[model samples]
Target: MNAPVFRRVLALLGDLRLAILLLLVIAIASIAGTVIEQGQSLSFYQTNYPEDPALFGFLSWRVLLALGLDHVYRTPWYLTLLVLFGASLIACTFSRQVPALTTAQRWQYYQEPRQFTKLALSTTIPQGSLKELATALSAKGYRVWQTDNQLYARKGMVGRIGPIVVHASMILILLGGILGALTGFMAQELIPSGETFHLQHIIQAGPLARIPQHWSVKVNRFWIDYTDAGDIDQFYSDLSVLDAEGQEVKRGTIHVNQPLKYGGVTLYQADWSIAAIRFRLNNSPVLQLPMAQLDTEGKGRLWGTWLPTKPDLSEGISLIARDLQGTVLIYSPKGEFLTSLRTGMSTEINGVTLTLVELVGSTGLQIKADPGIPLFYAGFALLMAGVIMSYVSHSQVWGLQEKDLLYVGGRTNRAQLAFEQELVAIARELASQSQTAEVQA
Candidate 1:
């Protein structure tokens, strides 16, 4: 690109108004991403947002798919916005913040006494000396510099660099966000107790995401805790991470809100279900039946299995369980309630002895891996430091000694009232010291 064109483009990108507009648009898109379900199937959108009477008259499944609302964060346009915003931050940092900081760091000494008159807070002390003024400023936490008859003092130079640091931190955050979107993956697995499995059911994955294949996770046990009112208090799963050689590398008991993290992946305990029921019938070999979750119409989750009471499959009984508390309800073939049994309990039904062995529970885990989390942590730390630094007032004071008269003036980028008061106090101290020196003379 030509120099003039490049400069124009840089100016455009560095414009504060443009940056603010982009930030607002990005915020709105983020809100939309949160309101609309992401990473869901097409059927889910169609069922939830029907076309006959579209949501808000325009948010149907077709619109969502066309606009990539179903996966907004992973969309090409969304990534483009992020890239553009990052570029804007870079331009603004280089074009504005850096130059401003450089200017603030350079010293500008006031050689002429008249120069002090242009300052925001200036005063003429008839008998005060520049040495006394410098001493007072130094005592007030200013870094004083003396050049013969001219003097300059400043404090809080870090405040000048604060905007630059803030910009750099924001850039890091953007880079981290982009990296996560390009390389993160999320998967869900429903593993029965005592079973080992790998991440296979991938729900969402970025283009560059690497799915691990050399490791597996085993659920050693799954159980639930109940409150005194019989409500579910919490559920837990004892999990073990195994390497390619089938050797356990890590083990932990994970519950809701407490997840297990290994390598780069994290395993969250999300849900649970009854996998199967083991029992014995009429002294026969032990058999297990898979349980199916029935539609409870919002009453609660219920798992059921059918056990044949007769050898010819002519009669059967339904076994229903509401929780992992070991209580199982048995119903007759006619849908009538028969009796309840617990684990290790036995009851005779239709002349055949039914023994309840165990109820195998499965743990639902949501596994995710993101490579940009460290960058995010570092970026946020810098952002906080930068904000605190920015709050510090960058104050500068100038002094000039012409003959026996001293000129003192100062200015600050922020905390104007406090800076003025500090300058007045320094002037008063200089006058007092001058008087004391005359008395000693």
Candidate 2:
């Protein structure tokens, strides 16, 4: 890139107006995302707003394509805004706060009565000397002192830097957001138990289709815990990282709130489903064929419609038994049971045997990939630094001696009243102590 073009780019990045505009845009877009059901299919919008295809199509497809609302967080424009904001923060650091910090570091105290009368904070002390006041200020633990015809008192002035540091931290946070967006990709999959698969493809759209690849993740098990009231308390899944050879390399547990990290990617236990149901054949110990499993025709065992031949299971009637309490209903067909039996347990009926098998759990895992996290954090730090500097400021008091009298005054960009209160307290304490000493003498 040419030098002029690069400088122009930098200027645009630091432009406050552009940054503010980008922020507003992101805000508006985020609000819209919240208002509209993001990532929903066209049919859902159509069903919800049947009378208005215009609105439905606009929200369902047009807006999604235009702004990447279908994947709002990872949209290029949104990422652009974040980058612009971060650049603005960096620019602000260079253009504004650095100089102020420089100026504050070299601060000197210069005071006079004429300046005092002109000061917003002023006190006329005819009975006390500048040295006495300086002594009083120093006793109050102020580190700033003034000489050369000027008295200076500064206390807790460094406290002003805290907010700037906080702002810099915020910039770091924004930078994190950006980094997490650009170099990051997430792949979602619902893997059924007793099945092994790899995360092979991630959906990334752009000038060309983007396919994201990561180290394979294999789900081992998933479980859910419930509260006493039967509500779910927490959900978790057991997973292992796999090498290219399909060998398990690492293992960990992940939950809804807790995520497992490996190879710079995170896998979250997002959700679960009933993947398959197993049934014992005629009370046999070993013949446990999962009934809810998909058959060649895409029908599960629950559908009770299966061919007599299968690769995994031996050919048979492919029977699935349902529990009927107080009545033994033999159901060979889809909906009807052949006979009705009683509902109580331990009750035996003739001619047929039924046994329950293990229920297979399917786990839903959310996968994420990011490469620019550090840069984003850096921007976040700068942003926080700028904000804190803008909000918090250092101020001090300066005292002066001119022949017969003394002068004391202070000024600060922020919290001037608190500074004044401290100054008054110091002055009053000194006056009271002098009176007490005189009385003792």
The whole-model lDDT of each prediction reads 0.91, 0.61
Task: Name the best candidate (by TM-score).
Answer: 1
| TM values, all candidates | 0.98, 0.73
Clashing pairs in 1: none
Give a tens-digit lDDT track for model 2, residues 331-396. Answer: 433444444333222212233354444445678887776655665666566655556555554667
Q: Lowest summed lDDT over 10 consecutive residues: which window, candidate 2?
A: 320-329
**What ranges in model 1 sit over 4 Å off?**
439-441
lDDT score of residue 63 within candidate 2: 49
User: What is the total number of backbone clashes in candidate 2?
Assistant: 37
lDDT of 1 by residue, 67-118 (tens): 9888888888888888899999999998998888888889888878778778
Could you tell me the TM-score of candidate 1? 0.98
